[model samples]
Target: MRDLPVLTGDAVADAATDWPIAEHRVLGRGRLNTFVSDTVVTPDGATMVRDYLTHTGAVGVIALDEQERVVVVRQYRHPVGFKLIEPPAGLLDADGESWLTAAQRELAEEARLRADDWRTLVDYMTSPGCLQESIRVFLARGLADAPRPEGFVLEGEEADMEVCLVPLDDLVAAVFAGRVQNPTLVVGVLAAHAALRSGREADLRAPDAPWDARGAKAARDQELGELEAP
Candidate 1:
């Protein structure tokens, strides 16, 4: 048998690459997201038009209390027609706000809570094939109750959202049983579980860890927008 290469932790990194864009156009613009189409040239000399949504990115917080309970919110997702159990999360719509600030703000606004300890749990691209939405999930401990953000009022689906705490072990089981399908919650639960089991929670990335993919995505979006402009 051929000798296999030794496994190294460094081999799993994701690299950034882009194809040449021949054309770009906005198909539609909604309140929070934009639908666009791009004509990209493949390396094999074929050109294809791809339609996708341009998002503002987002952050989610897995707030764990002293008893290993995770604070979560049940909110209705109109497009999916299901009320998903998700961690406190929100978009990066506020200009110039850092991702950690966004995560902290969301935890308060959506769950009426705050945390003194914070670490990055994971960062992922949601539907990278068609959507440009990047999400950062944070593990927040040292929990305490806090008032909602000033001038923040829940509306529509958020108005009916319910906040509750569930044991982390239960959440992990739900994830494996296919009971919870929200991407953020699934990834956050599994990552947090592994971190705790491996005793590496403290060694996770800092709350303000550098996120180059998000910055690169924003820059590419700007260039595409400029190209689509008259």
Candidate 2:
């Protein structure tokens, strides 16, 4: 693995010190929505940058089954003014729970699948240039059926999601065809693919076919190892 670049405390402090907020305003706030505008003096001091953004908490999953099919959702997106095909996802609404907990809830709500295997893939800014929300993507496996929660319904909202299963290669091809454009979906799918490949390699390296009582545990361990590290 390539070593990541280190950032010193002094460097971060210098950068923070250079940022001066001259003015700020609360643009608006509605159900699960908050908007704000801020004026910041740039490092060069030639111009002031005014930033406006909306903030929300988001969660998504790359759900895979023993058959290797990935669960996806088809929903209408108003922002893009079109229908979008993507993974099971939703906004975080529960208080006091960690982000991963919210991800598990969404996975159960959207796809009705509870994954015995869970791993956080990445935390990323969805649109740093305009939005203040950060999205957490997770990989889920060893799925079992669950009853859909009552409060987790998204019907009558601006979205109507239909759950579907897609083969891995077909989904990747759709991504390249511009059919799957959601950012979180792309990242989560790729991460799951890499994890699956790693699990296969580990199995090949094992000395024996761990098919007895030890076999199931060995297989689960391989999956967990690939998950936790990424």
Candidate number achieving the greatest TM-score relative to the actual structure: 1
RMSD of candidate 1 to true structure, Å:
1.8
> What does the lDDT read for residue 22 in candidate 1?
92
Give the distance in Å from residue 124's predicted Cα in candidate 2 to where it truly belongs.
Answer: 1.6
lDDT of every predicted structure (CA atoms):
0.93, 0.67
Q: Candidate 2 overall Cα lDDT vs. reference? A: 0.67
**Per-residue lDDT of 1-230 in model 1, one digit per residue for the tens?**
99987767988677788888898888999998889999999999899999999888999999999999999999999889999999999999899999999999999999999999999999999999899999999999999989999999999999999999999999999998999999999999999999999999878999889987787797788788789788
TM-score of 2: 0.73
lDDT of 2 by residue, 1-230 (tens): 99998888667531112355565556776676546566677878855655555554577888888788889888788878877778888776666666677777787777787888676665566776666566777777788998887665566532467888988778778777877888888877766666576774233222111213223323533543453353
Backbone-clash count (model 2): 1
